[model samples]
Target chain A: MFEVRIHSRGGQGGVTAARLLALAAVRDGKYATAFPFYGAERRGAPVVSFVRIDDAPIRISSQIKKPDLVIVLDPSVMDVVDVLQGLKPGGRVLLNARERRDMKGYPTFTVDLTGIALREKLEVAGSPILNTPVLGALAKMGIVTMESAKSAITEMFSDPRNVSAAEAAYRELVA
Target chain B: MLTVATGNKAVAAAVKEAAPAVVAAYPITPQTEIVEQIAEYVSSGELKSQYIPVESEHSAMAACIGASVTGARTFTATSSHGLHYMHEMVNWAAGARLPIVMANVNRALGPGWNIWAEHTDAFQERDSGWLQVYVGSVQEAFDAVLMAFCIAEDERVLLPVMVNLDGFLLSHTMQPLEIEKAGDFIPPLHLPHAIDPQNPCGYGTLTGPDDYFRLRWDIERSMRDAVDVIRGTQERFARRFGRKYGMVDEYRCDDAEVVIVAAGTLGREAEVAVDLLRDEGTRAGSMRIRWFRPFPRLDLSGRDVVVIDRDYSFGFGGVLAKSIAATEGARPFSVIAGLGGQEVTYEDIAGFVRNRQPGRELWFGVNGDV
Candidate 1:
């Protein structure tokens, strides 16, 4: 089973990102489940969501303590939350940053999802939609096929910018 | 079509397929998504139903009963406080023998104010003459809702049905769901005693003391007869949709010496615990009680049982644990856990099996065994 933990602020669509990833995995002919860690969430409060993908139907519903991959949608949340706290030994980290950062020993992947969302003009109210663009980085990391990722995005969203933002992130991701 | 969706959306999807004539609901946390999705379907012309955004949950159920008596297929959804607020109408719907299907997102009753998964809310309605079915997955949620309409409307069992899904745990969780087109699986409702509003017939007439007990006994008689109806509906659903279900879902229990019994998602998680215990040479199994009201007869005579209850009765014992003891005569190790959505992992479930103490109660997360 491949478990993923996503960290982002409450209003940044972190939960939707988990759902999209799980949906993409399902489209790839695998079983998946996604859920959010409900807390006293507000606009800027740090929040977490989880996704589990496996060949068989996923049964475990508890929060993923040790995730195989950790994706940080907001690099600023890294200051308050330990994005690497319960990461497995061989786990990988994907960050929404313009440049790569040292993660001691873990393999880190960088993708400027915020820049891609803005470049594609994928803003909701006034914030760049990081959730859709992050799926492109996940696809680039071979977590899911680019085809399934785009399909999942279009299945839930109608705007063309969401797909463009994901495609841009898929090309710019430094894995 | 096979797709990924939350348990809430899955229920809404099934309701859409059933195409009820009326959907009257008031939204609440964890349960709001279900009514929202159904409302959207109605507004989008995908589902032709009278969607009533009721003022309160009481009015929600009341409107359903009002429409149901006039032979209209009705549906509604609610949660913890919303469910309690509609308590009177809940019993009225069942006592009146209205086949109104409801999806209740099970949540903890608040004193400190919490909105997470717990079975206490549904347990409170155990004897309301409603056939209760607790589901573990998004797919089961959809299937249960569809089958609920069939089971409730059967001539032999005209009782209401409540499909309970754990709040947040199942309601908010998204999983792969194969949406079945319930075309003709649920036949047209032919309510035997439906009142025609145009004729102006009096309904809910006062029951005199002489015949009150008989009326109550009739409810029980129909409740007992519902078992067969439920079985037939499930069997037909399986043959048509290719997915089968039963009153109890057993995992690895064929040759096991120890069994863990639970309901809802805890029941699904127990399967993983069974696998973990098997590696250590312990023959542990899991029996998930899907049907709560008109409870299925359990077969755990020789096995040592470990029962996990996500609900408590306060001053008594765990509702599930005590029910098993009363019916099966097995003194199970009652482990009270997951109240207000405290995380209960499969590892913890395996430990409960490892440390089996019959005839004892353990309040998990609190100190010792009582």
Candidate 2:
């Protein structure tokens, strides 16, 4: 089972991102699970969400320490937290920024999600979160399918507003 | 008899056929319709069982465990947060080896709060030693509930089974399902329930550290062995209902040089991609897993494997790929994609097939800007 660890501030959609990831897997007919570990479980606190994706049933049950893939949704998390602590030697890191990883440790890519989210109109009260836009980049980058990501978002939001916003974010990211 | 049915309705049919003596549940998102249908049966007197409509999900599973211990086949259903609220009871039921069966209309858990389908509910409960199964189409969800009962109640494997349903996909989505007649479903799997005066015994014993490990080991062993039962039970269900469910569903993979792995609803989408790829002469294949608990590794070997994981493992990527990697002596190329409910596309999948590695992981579709 492949575990994905996401780092974001509380309310930055880390947990939402995790669930969306699982829902996307569901859309693709893959056995997937997502959860998060937060100290305060409130807004603004640093947050981390975990996802286990597999073609088979998952058995290991522990907070993932070493991640095969680490996604830093919020750039500030890179400053305050150790995002690279437990990365596998050759693991790839996806960051939400315009600048690629200049730090020495691992392979990284920087996609300007705020720019995509703004174009896609996927903002909550003027705050353009990077989740869906990043998803779009992942799709273009040849990871999972865009349909599965869309399905996951559809599965996530009951509000058409949220769904449409996610779609816009996707379009903007791709655009 | 065989008739077109929705996924939730299929689960209800399976529960009815299992004929649990006492079924307790509270209506919650996606999972509500299940109890609604079963309640109809109870009211119509078509089924003989105590249908307890409790106030909450915790009470629902609580009633189920109490009934099971008292020698009644017990069942219930819930969604995301509801499952989280009653998460403790899930472990209690399985730890007690109560053999309870429930359907989770897989929903997203809340902080900002959402009522959509996702595996977070069951995913949070994976280590509880409860047998977990993910169904892709409504047909699989329909039959998984029946197969779950047969497997759960097997004296050799008396653990709770959570037949996870995609919230709206199966929970709210409509589909055609074939159900076996009552007689055909029951009889072979009637379980012995607890009765006050008839039989006296312990319900759930508090395990001390000494015997706890061994008891848990036994449970794990049963869980391991339950893999075969999962396949066997599905086979028997197919014999009766004319469908099939195995640990893994391999599509267009017989002659495939490159393979993509996933489970649940994504399997259908991946199937679409695989078909499109075949038409385009890519020779790509897909493997969707039905059983999430006993991860079937028999089919995963050295072939190029691209694991698409929706959930995130903090330190590593691709929980499924890692599980597969642990089994294989040689690792294939794997990519980590689809996180936080991101949409996965066919073109994205085609790209993976195009850049195919036998055993490597690629993490894509992410934003580095916040």
Candidate 3:
């Protein structure tokens, strides 16, 4: 099983990112489950969601303690939360950043998801939509096929810009 | 359609397919999504049902009972405090032999005010004559709701059924689901005692002691009959939808010396624990009890039992552990865990089995008390 934990603020669509990733995994013919760790969260409060993908039917319902991958949708949340608290030894990290930062030793991938969303004009309210674009980064990292990821995004969202933003992130990601 | 959905959404989808005539519900946290989705379906003209947004859970159930007695298929959903608030109407729906189907998102009842996953809310309703089935996954939640209507409306068992899913844990969890057309699987409800305006019969009035005693007996008799009804409905459902369900979901129990017994999501997680113990050569198995009201006959006479109960009976003990002891006549190591959505992982479950002490109870995270 491949387990992932996503860190972001409450209203930043971290939960939806987890759902879209799981849906893409399902579309790729694997079993997947996604859920948010709901707390007394309001907008901008650091929140997390989990996703699990496996070859067989996923039976366990407990929260992931040691994730194989950790995704940071908002770099600001790293100040309040330890995104890599229970990451497995030599686990990978995916961050939504304009430029890469030095990590201890883990292989890190970076994507300017916010910049891509803004470029594609996928802003909701005032925040650039990071969740949809982040899927492209995940797909580029081989977490899912680009076709499956784009299909998953289109299945949930009718807006064509969400798909375009993902395509932009896929091309601009720095692995 | 193959898609990913939350447990609440799956229940709403099944309810929509069942095409209930009336859906009277009051929104409660965790369970609110189900009513919200159903109301959207009603508004979008996808589901043709009278959606009643009531003031309280009591009114929600009362409205369902009123509509159900009029031979209209009725549905409702509620959670912890909301379920307790409708305690009167819940029993009334069952006692009146109304085939009302309800989806209960099991949540913790509170003085501390929690909205997390727990089974005590539905556990307390065990004797209300409502057939209860706790689902472990989003797909099971969908399938159980579809089956609940058929089993409840069966002429042999004209009683309400409550399909339960753990709040937040299962209710909010998104999983791959295959939605099927429930075409003719749930035969149109034929309520024999439906209120007829032409005949104009009186019901629910004061009854004499003798008839009241018989009425109570009738509920019990039908309760016994429900076991067969549940089995037949499940069998037919499997034939139609290609998914089968049993009274208890067993995993690696065939050649095990010790078995962990549980219900709801905890029960599903136990399977992983069983696999871990087996890797260490401990011969562990899991039996997830699905039906709670007409409790199934478990075959645990020769195995050492480790029963995990998410709900406690306060002064008595863990309800599930006591139930296993009473029915199977075997002493079990009772573990009380996961109350108010305390995280009980597969590793913790495996540890419980490794430190098993028979005829004893251990409360996880509450040190020093056995």
Candidate 2 per-residue C-alpha lDDT over A27-55 given as tens digits, one digit per residue, 9 for 90 to 100: 66666656565333577778888777788
Q: Which wins on DockQ, candidate 1 or candidate 2? A: 1
What's the best-to-worst order under lDDT? 1, 3, 2
Q: Write the per-residue lDDT of candidate 2 for residues B209-324, one digit (tens) a residue.
A: 98999888988998988987777777877787677667888888888866778766666567767877899887788888677787677455546676766554556655676677
| Candidate rank order under DockQ | 3, 1, 2
For residues A20-127, could you state the per-residue lDDT of candidate 3 as single tens digits? 999999999999999999889999899999999999999989999999999999999888788889889989999999889865677899999988888888988988
DockQ of each: 0.90, 0.02, 0.92
Per-residue lDDT, model 3, residue B128, is: 94
- The fnat of each candidate, in order, is 0.85, 0.00, 0.88
Pick by DockQ: which candidate is best? 3
By lDDT, is 1 or 3 better? 1
Docking class of 1: high
lDDT of each: 0.95, 0.71, 0.94
lDDT of 3 by residue, B327-360 (tens): 8898999999999999999999999999999999
Instruction: Indicate whether candidate 2 or candidate 3 has the larger lDDT.
Output: 3
Residues A11-34 of candidate 1: C-alpha lDDT, one tens digit per residue: 999999999999999999999999
